[model samples]
Target: MTELQSTAFVSEDKFAVAQVALYILAVLQVVAAVMLATGGAPIPFPQQATAMQRLSGTVNAVVMVLAFAVVYCLLARCLRRPTKLVWRIALGTFLTNFGMVVLTMVAQPGPSPVLTGCLCFAGIVSVLRGCKSVKAYSHS
Candidate 1:
């Protein structure tokens, strides 16, 4: 094999863990989408949500779309090239998703506290994984 080809393969190894992190974030995004789409249950929201709350939901939806795009890009790059840039994208996705989760909890009622708590916990996982991936790639 050519030297450049061999070097490319070697460098790809550094990003294997990051690829896993990105895929995990993608799965979490899907989970969040399901929760938001289904309403998570039927939390009573006092006749109608206020304008601010409605705006928040709209924003959350937009964030989710962005998260999905990040996931797609990260996954594609990780699968195709496995570079540090892909890891950075995954980390960004995690932060965005976490922010959306927090916003949801603050702006809307969970079907129950338990559901919201579960989402928060999931968000924590994504954040932790993202951080770990960043550290791992940075060192490599």
Candidate 2:
């Protein structure tokens, strides 16, 4: 078989890996959203806060969650096929989040932070694997 034909087989596997990674990120985002909606520390408000205060907090939390969701969706779309853009986006988002999670772990020293850091690390590895697969398939 020709090189292109051989690459087609490899590319499909890479695409599947990328899709699995995206699904994992999606699940993580959903958990984060639920936490935020139920008063994650990032969106903290006073226990006896006024209605307006609560409303504003909710709005802010929703906006934050949606922003991440949109980015994840965009990355998913890029995974429709192996393009450099997918690699770039996956690298940027996961790496940035991993760094931030590390910072949070250092600052907080809590179990949740440890868990989140682990998850973030997994995400970084998975994205790299997927992108590397894409690169290999592309060059074939």
Candidate 3:
């Protein structure tokens, strides 16, 4: 490879951890959905829960799982190409996720939520920095 090409090539090793992180989030979402759908008993529901509340929670869980799956796919794509588009997708995903975490913490404070938000913020910085090292190849 030419020196220019060598310098432009973004190391995949940098983003490998990001892909693994995405997988962890996806797995968590799937597990949460499964647990909620299976029993809805995981969380205490006072005397009883209305059908609407149960349905709403189940649907929400399913949506979260689906969203995470999409983000995971983007991360995989980024690992493969490290292109600008993939980096944008990763940035957008983490930005929204970080926003949600902040909102959740503000509305209802929790240790776990805080930790998750910090982790997501870190992921965003990691990806943005990694993206700086990549440039789409141009064949002349």
Best by lDDT: 2
Weakest ten-residue segment in model 3 by summed lDDT: 131-140
Candidate with best TM-score: 3
- Distance from true position, residue 13, model 2, in Å? 2.2
Clashes of 3: 0
**Predicted structure 1, TM vs. truth:** 0.39
Per-residue lDDT of candidate 1, residues 47-111 (tens digit): 57996786577567757755774755456465444335654554555466556667776887566
Candidate 2: segments with Cα more than 4 A from true spot = 1-11, 15-18, 40-42, 46-50, 130-140
What are the TM-scores, per candidate, against the unseen true structure? 0.39, 0.66, 0.67
What local lDDT does model 1 show for residue 17? 43
Clashes of 2: 0
List where candidate 3 sits over 4 angstroms from the true fold: 1-12, 39-64, 136-140
What are the clashing pairs of model 2? Answer: none
1-140 per-residue lDDT for model 3 (tens digits): 69767556544355655666676666656666677678742645556889788678667767776777776765865655577767777778778889999899989998867866876787787777666554532111
Estimate every model's Cα lDDT from 0 to 1: 0.55, 0.70, 0.69
What is candidate 2's lDDT per residue for 46-105, written digit by digit as tens? 889999998887878777876777677678677766677767777777678778878887
